[model samples]
Target: MPPAPLLLLVFNRPSLTDRLFEAIQEHTERPIYIAADGPRADRPADIEACQGVRDLVLNRVAGRDVRLRFQPSNMGLANHIPSAISWAMEHEDRLIILEDDCVPLPGFIPFADELLERYQGHPSVAQISGSNYQNGISRTPCSYYFSGIPAIWGWATWKRAWKLYDRTMPGWDALRNTPWLSSLFHDPTHAHYWRTLFDDAAHPAKGSLESWAIPWTFNLWTHHQLAVTPDSNLITNTAQSAGTNSSGTSHRNMSPATGIEFPLRHPETVSRNEEADAYAMESFYLGSHPVERFFWRLRLPLRLAPLRRILRLARRHLTHPQPGA
Candidate 1:
């Protein structure tokens, strides 16, 4: 079957969008949907850049089956992304989604297409993610492994799964204080990290980072759903440092995009890879070792505490715990 329809989400990034669109054109002949969020009023340069991206995509897509949704006003990432996906899903049952910076490798489209069909109506599998953040570690011998953490750098999902996304995350209030989140992970720190993020996502302070993916992940978790992550990293995030919300360069951005092998090896059963999830939580999300993370929760006054002292103390205590001290 033809690959599932693809949706490209763009903003004020013409060069990145063009690069990603070229990759898509070379890979699949499926219908393409382009969604661009409008320029921010505060950024005068955004107007011209956004239009340039729109013009570039339109020019490239000549007579192909393409649909466009260019917003008149800025809806921001949290609103625009979910809204765009919802709009596209109204026409297609399933869709492969990519941001302007997420360039896919050769086999990503077909890989997603196969899994989209394979996991159709599978209650546990809510997403097919092309990005793997295992730092070259293969969690399973199978072509892909199931994860509770949904990676959205490049991904595909069905309308049924998208329907569960709620921006406000209404259910978070009831589950926040309970052990429900803790039960999902092998380490309590992982659960604690997510709980803090979900708390901020559900009840946002003014001028905070607006992330749609966090709530979407929470929605999946609340419903006990998992995402299929390929063993090989198939997508490269090209704009990690230059993007509007990015803090600085990351090692993840340096990772190369590699294609998946054909004739996928299917897993015998559907289950989340706890080891992989823990690794992701520690290395990717927290960006620290387990001992360092333990010290992070102590709420030590940074101004008074020296970094070297804290690390030295953390190493000593974490490496050797006292009995009933």
Candidate 2:
């Protein structure tokens, strides 16, 4: 079967865009939609970098047809991303999404395409995420499992799902006061983590900090939609210091993007994988320990501070050469 339409989100990251586009060379015949945010006037280097990204995509990327949407001014993440995806869906029923930093494995596109078709009309299935952050734990007997979390490093969704996205998170006002929000998660701690995030994202005074994904995730959870995730990760995020939202380094930063075997094994049931979801909640979403969770809750604003400190310590350890070395 032909590949699904691909939508690539890029900004001032030509080198990363070049690398990611090279990985998509195998899909030379696939039509691609490239959405690039305008360079920030404050950052002079952004002008050249953004131009390089456009040049690379137009001249070098091996695709049959290319569509470009370059913003005139910096729309930032909150505005650029959803608008771009909406633009793509205007031409196609579904499209695979990849940021400049998300490098896909050989089977990532096909894996997403298969599931997107399988669950096209299934209201419960919100998306097909190419990321699986279970830390090598086998969460399913099938090739993929279901969860409420939608990892967007590399993912795909249909028009039906995208239509449900609320840019302003309209239900926050009603949901924030009720027990409905907490009941969605397995524990109060997870609920607290998400509630804090939702509150912050929709804060009237802090409106500028609003991002698109938190609202998308909120839309999924309120509707009780689940995302189909692979048993193993298929996309490795290589953003590092160049990441738009994230910085510093950690054990989870660069997991291998291993290819999936063809002829996937499908689960007979369509229910969410509770065990895997719990693992993600504890390991990736919330902290495993109560004390750690408390600190994480406290560190939301300064989350990157701890990561920077950890990276510094790691550099020191490496440079000093431990006793064994």
Candidate 3:
């Protein structure tokens, strides 16, 4: 049998799932896998989003081959996504991951396939992401430096790196003890949101969003893994609920590269677009509420005193976010 090249992890966002399927259908030759999260208990939104995901899995159109891994009940976002991805990836050497909120352009498939082969076992190559926050990154072309932030929109990864995937919060206290590692904390200029995020994840009465990404970043940082990206943005993220804790909000500038051209390319070196990385850290961590992400590039060795305090405050706030829409 041919190897499994792609895996689509869908929750209850049928609308977004439909858009994703439409994008995938545009180039439907690769093998596809769909993992649907079982319904959850405390969900507030209309489960209507999930229905579209179900439909896509059931109604496979012109794909080369497809498989479905459906959950019996809701497992919530954190469990559903990481579990589904780890499961699918366990079966393949490397696989691409797509969340429903992300919509891919035509070049997404070729972009992923080319990178999958290019970085098959390169230790430095952690994952191949498909979006570029840098507006002018395309001019340089080929591949660019690693972004601390990993994009779920139209992305691929190798299982060798997946082995480091720690679903359970491993070495939390130990993570804090590594002072030099503190430099990896998303720059203060970029926003110390991940610190706050992990804090919330640690709370007993909290939801799971903060837990997943924080640990994932920790994995990449500790191992010194590099994540490269294509010049043209491949996936679109439609999940920005805008406000902190997301209270049914909306805004513009939501889609960055809506229809940007994506092209396949040969191997090349790409440097860190620090300016763009700064922007992504701000938006992803601090929320798009105009709060800029912080950066402490000068704090080379990472003094444990201040880093500890910052991490503590972030945890406190994430667990009990300030009043906002």
Candidate 4:
């Protein structure tokens, strides 16, 4: 089957964009839609970098069915991303989305294509994600599992799902004072972490939005939607330092990008994998909660012991010089 239409979100990062473009070319020659946020006025360097990226992408996709939405002025990430996606969804029913930093594995496009078709009619299945953060643990016996959380490192979704996305998170106002979060997450810590984040996203103090993913996830949860996560991680996020929100830090034991096997062994029933969801919540999102933070601090020394021991052994080896010398 032909691959799903792809929307490549880009900005001033030409190097990352070039790498991701090459990876996409290596995988499939599907119709490409490139959206670039214009350079920020305050950052003089952005002017040249953004133009360079636009030129590079246009030159590379010279002989293809490629579309462009290069913004004239910077919309910022929180605004640009959703708007760009909305623009793309207007043209296509289903779309595979990748950011300039999200380098996909060989199987990512094919995996997304298959799942997009399989779940096209299923309204409850909101998206297909190429990210798996289970630290090598298979959440299900099948090729993919459902989760309440949507990993957007690399993902695909239908127009139906995209239509549900509201950046303001209007539903949070009604559910904030109630037991809605608790009902969704059994663990109070996990619930609390998300509640605080949702509150912030819903009502930004400075009238500035920090993330599009938070509201996107909020929309999924409010609508009781599930995201399909592959058994293997298929997208590697290479924008640690260059990303808007990333702090150049990684999870303690997150899984790395790997290819998914063909002829997917799908789950018999479409249901959320609670255990997997909980692990992700704790490892990725809940780390900032006061209680979770305390516990993580307590465990930090223990988690570093193995690395410390390795360093000690290396020092001893260097001091003794007993092997080849």
Measured by TM-score, the strongest candidate is: 1
lDDT of 3 by residue, 1-325 (tens): 3333678877766666677777777555766778887655465453554565676668764345776888877765656767877887766888878777667776666667776786787767788887765544453444445665665556788888888878554665566545434465445533334444444454424223433555666677667776776655666777653211221111223336544343444445534555556665544434333312232333224333344355456545766899991
Whole-model lDDT values for every prediction: 0.81, 0.78, 0.59, 0.80
lDDT of 1: 0.81
Q: Give me the displacement of residue 84 in model 4, in angstroms.
A: 0.7
The digit string of per-residue lDDT tens for model 2 on 1-325 reads: 4568999999888788888888787875778899999988787777888888888777875545888899977888878999999999999889899999899998998898888888889969989999887878888778998877888889999998999898778889888878886667657666766776677566634223436888899988878899999998899887553536332223343346666787999988788887887677767655333444445445444333343354456556666878987
What are the runs in model 3 whose C-alpha is more than 4 Å off?
1-4, 42-52, 61-64, 135-143, 185-191, 202-211, 241-255, 258-275, 291-325
- How high a TM-score does candidate 4 get? 0.85
lDDT for model 4 = 0.80
Clashes of each: 0, 0, 22, 0
lDDT of 3: 0.59
Segments in model 4 whose C-alpha atoms lie over 4 Å from true places = 207-209, 243-254, 287-292, 295-325
Q: Give the TM-scores of the predictions, in the order they appear.
A: 0.87, 0.85, 0.74, 0.85
Cα lDDT of model 4 by residue, 1-325, tens digit = 5678999999998888899988988644777889999988788888899999999998888888889999998988888889989998888999999999888998998899999999998969999999987868887789999989999989999998999998888868988889998888898767766665676678765533367898999999888899999988898877553534222112233468878887889899999999998988766654323444444334333222242344345545656778677
